[model samples]
Target: MSDNFSRPQHTAPLTPILQLVNSAPIVLVAFFAIGLSWWFLLIGVIFLVVGGFGYWASWQRRFFWLNEEGELEARSGILFRRSRQLRISRLQSVDILRPPVARLLGYSSLKIEVAGSGDSRVILSYLSVGKAQELRSEILALAKDERTSTQSAEPADHWKWQVPNGRLVASLVLTTSTYFLIIGAVASVAFALVEPGSGLVTLALAVGGSTISLIAGITSLFNFSVGRNDRGIAISHGLFTTAHYTVSPIRIQAICVVQPIAWRPFGWYQVAINVAGADQSSKKSGPRVLIPVVHEDALPELFHELLPSWNLEIEDEWLASAATSRWRFPWQAARLAVSLTSDLFVVRSGALTRRLSAAPHERIQSIRITQGPWERKLGISSLHADSVPGPVRLRGRGLASSVAVHTALAELDRMFTARKSRKSEQW
Candidate 1:
């Protein structure tokens, strides 16, 4: 019964029917269907009308109002008329989502995440593009103001890692190539088993499938974007439902940078962080946002701006003193080896890109050390690391064979203990 409508920080006008009609896929599908039957055309017309009204209704129900009182109000659900109220202080992270059509319509959706148990959250769709920007700016200002008021000294810049374009290209090529190969292999096998009479049909189907895969890969390029500014990082990506994530440094629990095998050639890597209440995916999924590609050089700057608390020493000068014995190692690696290693250890050092040292630790969920028969004979071993966020094994991608299995266990111990200690301190 609250009749007083508070002032909204921003508002988005509902997208119209003309905007939906402009979509290429919908237009193409509707055109093709109409050509097949008058009945189809009738159904299409009805759909367009009903769908437009529904879009408007959904828009009306999904508006938001952020007042000067440091509170956020979201109105949603057409029939149920549900609304949520929350203090801005409790907000965890604010995510902006824009679908392909939403992009064309120049609008985005907003999700206000808060720290609480169960399904306590607020989401508003159809926020005008301008309003989304304003809201982001406002939130950043408020968060900064609050922090500045509380503390006199600011944290130093430490973490500086962003996805590189080269890595993105490499990832795209690898993904597309694998998909095409898989499709071709499967189609060839199927055709070989089929009768000769349908040879032409099978060939056509194969070509069509390959073309779709190529298109999908091309579409993925739009998913590429950037993350910047002081409030935190904002990543924009997706083919259908374009996702935008805005994370603040205060909420970050851990930040991890990973380089997978496929991207090793291009020196491409991914950066993700374990954040508090921000990892929206299931418990099995990795941390919040995945910057699928990034240059190694930029990581230092990005880290400094985003996570000042890490105090990461990423310079080659510092690395020089860390030591390498046919294998590179960090100060933490020595501790890992001491605590985790049962007997043998593996230490691998790279002149440029990768350096690893691993050891076994107590109460390990899974520990694996792998080596080829040649390595086995030579008494060399490779160490593997795994946890709830998934495994990170440094064995492959060109490390030496002389590294013993014992080295790996120690490295594992070092890595886990450091992380656990850091986590405990944060608490």
Candidate 2:
């Protein structure tokens, strides 16, 4: 294995074949459809031939390398001819993914994300496991403006939090989805008992959906753990498709701690964070999940590990919703509050599932205040502290108009001061 990726390098030669194998489900379905009609066989063959050719062409065309300017550059596409270059300084996170087939074949994929890219990402797929790891390390080192050294052993990571398998299983079982699944199964069984064929479809649907959901949850969170090293925070998880992510602390825009009503009794809380460049639209538990499940007592230590500079303690001077907001929030008006700490802006909301969202002053991209016609009549407004896209939403809803305006201005001042100080600090 050579450390020099300065020259454009093609991925593993087996990439095309592996891609075809990965699409086996679609091929299987096409074969199954052909059984219904002899004429369908022609369509299936054409699809297979076309898809195979496309995969081969894609593999042949795609190439990636580290450019002289210390940027990651990738080129792909057979006909369109696409090229992408990402600056090392803008790199947000690096991830390595090993799907079932790739894992079995000793291959992995490297994903590099940059700030403000939305859903767009640079993916180098089907590289040998060792090569991918080496490439990842090189990229990370380059991103940090450090010299890459092959002789130096990788820095050891301090394991901070690990989710026990039993706890994760318990957490999955206690979810609202699981409860609904159980109810659906019972109803389907009862209906079938009354009329054998009446609930057959319902039973299958309920069982299928629940099975898929359960498997996805298990696969995503299996062996979940978090660690910190000199470079950044590391998150590794997944069963069928293992994923390792290295997230820079400075890339974190906001964080939220959530506690479902059911989880409250057990003192369990889920932590999620907003990171620039990561896809927030992913349905599966992805990079946004800081910690899947943590005890209430562990939150303080966990927060410190993630963002040691920012003081995340909830302040006592929380401004609750205005009296007129009772008409809108009803039972939750009292619980809805927004507070500003010395270094962070916090929003507390939710009746059933309590959410505490906090954004550091330096990460606050913008502050917004809105008053709808109905809100104006109620003499209330809402303030939103916008950050990069993610689950952590810092919003103060149903606040007195005057308070909302005052808070917005105060937050803006804090953000300017924080940004000035932050500029002096190095990553």
Candidate 3:
């Protein structure tokens, strides 16, 4: 594990330009808030340019390279100097994000996302795309106890998924999130124009914020790609701001496969996972998307690729919408479905947005069963297998009978006990 390879010395040369491009929206908002006149804004723009360059110049002084102890180190600051070091083995995720403009400028930003403290990320901006990719491969290799990727056209022995443009657009449109923003934006405009009151204007201003979400959703959906190899699972997407995120699949704790109301008809599903070191604060913000959208036909192989142990073929009966239990919990528990395979337990529920949650047995920390008065009277209950936080929740409501629920729980306990006995064989 010698640090023999030549590594990147500093941030890309166009760091200032990339920073300015990313900061433009914030700068504009600040100007609008301050009621800056056109001439004043012009002056502010000049200052912004100068300040961006100054920040970049100061930032680049922090050289990034392998230190003697085999750690990624950075030395920075102009007036009050600062230095930081991150253990190569402790790195959680390495990402390359390229805004459209940055790509045109032949530059991208590298995000080194790690665990523990909130927002503890190391960012290197303006790296040439090739250089960024190279650095990422090298760092990831060192961290994962492997060699860097070959210079071949593609990685060998891997599962790669390409999301078609049509599917991406369809998923984005069909996604409730996209329309929620659009509706908010439309309502904001309507209010601002139709009712000219200060209070209404404030509300409109609040709703106007959805404009950014709409734009982000559109930009985020572009060129989404997912794949898995011996090293880990890799996800790269975005057009306006392309990003490459990689995580070791072994670290994946839970998975949530979602089919929105509109996309359900087409059988389009989005799979999101919670990995060992991922931050779970906001679903939309984090880079936790496993597969943005894929049709049903592709799921068998996709599931195996991402979670091999949990590749439990769910039969149609297991996906049963518990129509008979509709009276118990209305639409909420109407579509309840649950299945347990040797390695994985899956629960599918939700009316408007059909959700399929899967968690490997090794990750299941606890299990519980509950019944309400009416459910008890009906000799039915709900089952829950709780695990660490993320998108995955294993809960099946409206079981057909209490005896069946107990049988399932007993089976779960037996399977878990057997798996524990054969620890090496478990997922």
Q: What does the lDDT read for residue 339 in candidate 3?
A: 75
Model 3: per-residue Cα lDDT over 11-56, one tens digit each = 7666776677766777777677777788668767786878787877
Ranking of candidates on lDDT, top first: 2, 3, 1
Cα lDDT for residue 414, candidate 2: 93
Ten consecutive residues with minimal summed lDDT in candidate 2? 146-155
TM for every model, in the order presented, reads: 0.58, 0.82, 0.77
* TM-score pick, better of 1 and 3: 3
RMSD of each: 8.8, 4.3, 5.5
lDDT of each: 0.51, 0.82, 0.71
Q: Pairs clashing in candidate 3?
A: 12-126
Which 10-residue window of candidate 1 scores lowest in summed lDDT?
314-323
Tens-place lDDT per residue, model 1, 1-427, is: 1222355432455554434554436646777866658776776677777777776676655656766576677766778886777666766666676766677868776666666766556766557777665665565455555555442222222333433445455576665455666576676667767754455565666667766775665455445565554445555565666656555544444334555455666665555544445444564212344455666776566556554455433222211111232233333333222112232122333433333332223223355666666544544455454322322232321223333344444456655575455442121
